[model samples]
Target: MTAHTATTLRSAGSTGISLPEAIRRADLGDAVALLASAKKYTVARLSGGRLSVPGKGSFADGAGVAGTSTERALPLSTSGPDAVFEARIFNKDAELRWLHEGDGLGTAVVLSESPDICRPLGEFLDPLYAVEQIDNRYLLWGRPLRSHDSGASTGPLSTGPLSTGPLWVRLAEARIGLLDVPVSRAPRENECVFLRTVEYVTTEPEHGNAYVAEERLVELFLAPPEQSKAAGSPQPDRLPEATR
Candidate 1:
């Protein structure tokens, strides 16, 4: 299939659009559709070759599965800073599981992976105020609340209290590299594997009644546990100004 670039809508006004709706209108479909189409290196298929485009029938596998009642344990490495941390993106709860198992640190870090799953997770979370839904399975990472009296400027607009929110391009440019790793064919229950080089876009809701915003070309990177920290740190706030 030919690749298509999705358009973003900023609000719920006449021409404004919600992030989810914009994604559908952009013809990119859901998270799976966006990921499958954006990354040429990843292989995706449908049961009958119907072409799983978003908003057209049931496209992605396990599209509406409920969240898993039980949390799965992730494998960690014991090799200190130099180890491999593997994660599975598919879960009934739509969560991304990060299992770090190598040397001495063997722990499972499970947050709302869906925040990281969508195209503009960073943009959404940088704000100071926004509403989120837990039943949606996908994590809605929103920014903190902003006061109308506090004059903070962002992006192209400058207002005393009404900021323009975060910049989408900066979020998209964050240098998260992608890797394709070999996944296990047959694994036990709650066990999943995957090849790397995964990519997807994110749509974050704006504060108040403004349009839902989105970020494109969000890349996923896999690095050594130590390298991942160094790369992800530095900014250590919301989304970095720029990713390598």
Candidate 2:
């Protein structure tokens, strides 16, 4: 029912809970499930450079991230199709600011405070957005970076690609960073949560998994089409581009 559900394997209280305790209990599976299922969450789009955790006063970028597990936390994530939703959650990254009881680190942002996305956004994204629910990963159809007119995106996120193709995110990675900002349903995309970055991320159509956009990341429409039948539904493994 809540984002914390991913952080903790056990069901989180529908209302009022301790952020640290929830995170402490959350495992990778719980986090992935939360990201795949939560209606919204705040996801951090890597500003630039490789993903790294910042200490209270400085940024740390070492390959071995295991040491920061107990103290690392990032305070941002973009949600909603096309990444229109953004929210601030407890500052659990690097600073461990949440450890301070009265700092208001884990305080949840009010849904009303989020911006409104035009119905067109939902309509535009609905055909391409969806949640995998079980795979613990976000998938999207891929388009080249040049396909768009704007070339200002110089960040590493312009398009999602591995050594050969587009990029993919672990469900837990996306969910933990995202805070679903609220918007009333206009187009169906408004009804779901997505993984986004600061810049656009690209994935190939045949890739099955979707890409994450930067500024407003895209959650690939992996779910079955609202208009389609489920009898022969395409699973992620057989992704015929999951949704329309």
Candidate 3:
């Protein structure tokens, strides 16, 4: 995954139309085309209950009951009802469930940030997209490498470095010292640290909102490596420009 290689893959068979741009113009054909051009991610074509992977075996759906149907989604995994894909995001692992409809046209992309839900039993999708049988949609799934640790709670319950305000080497969509607390991590030129929020505020304050002092440090998500490289190091005052 060198810089040159990544650039070459992105330029390969490119139509000069990005996914967001195609969606903005309401161009389904261009969007599908752009998605198909992506070389790094898995892209499959579905037709007549058969899924055709470019360099893999074609899978046929199994027997089904009345309302629910089983899909033989071997591209993600084999001999299981679950389909998971793992991708590196923000230098850490982010997992999402790859669920498909009876026809395998519609997919439910669920983020795996919770542990209570079994990895096999997935949840609903966030920012779901629709694609025809001929179109290709990006899939994401699987539990994080540290699945033994629970990701469901946002509170800093563990008395490890997490509660002691670990130093942050990077950040995204946030600024240093935004929280009303003492900043002890003496961030470098572009680095920051986690801070525990002493109070919490809720929206709809005009109506009725709870005011409590919740001792917890909100989650911090880092930017993707590609985006970080593109934007360069972030300044203390501003975050890096978002990439499409």
TM-scores for candidates 1 onward, in order: 0.19, 0.22, 0.17
**Local accuracy by lDDT, each model:** 0.23, 0.22, 0.21
Better-scoring candidate (lDDT), 1 or 2: 1
Task: Name the regions of candidate 1 deviating beyond 4 angstroms.
Answer: 1-14, 18-20, 29-217, 229-244
Candidate 3 residue runs with Cα over 4 Å from true position? 1-91, 95-118, 123-186, 190-244
Instruction: Give one digit per residue, the lDDT tens place, for model 1 in 43-127.
Output: 1111121122123222123221111121122222234332333322322223222233333222222222343333332223332
Compared with the true structure, what per-residue lDDT tens digits does model 2 show for residues 1-244?
0111111011111113233332332211111111211243232222221122323322122111112222234442333342212122211111101111222233211111012311211111112122211222222222112111123321112322222111222121232331212111111111122222122233456966645321222232222233222323333333222111
Best candidate per lDDT, number? 1
Q: By summed lDDT, which 10 consecutive residues of candidate 2 come out lowest? A: 1-10
Q: Count the backbone clashes (under 3 Å) in each candidate.
A: 35, 45, 3
**Which should have the higher lDDT, number 2 or number 3?**
2
Show model 2 residue runs off by greater than 4 Å: 1-15, 29-73, 76-244
Global CA lDDT computed for model 2: 0.22
Candidate 1: residue 178 lDDT (0-100): 24
True lDDT of residue 121, candidate 1 = 21
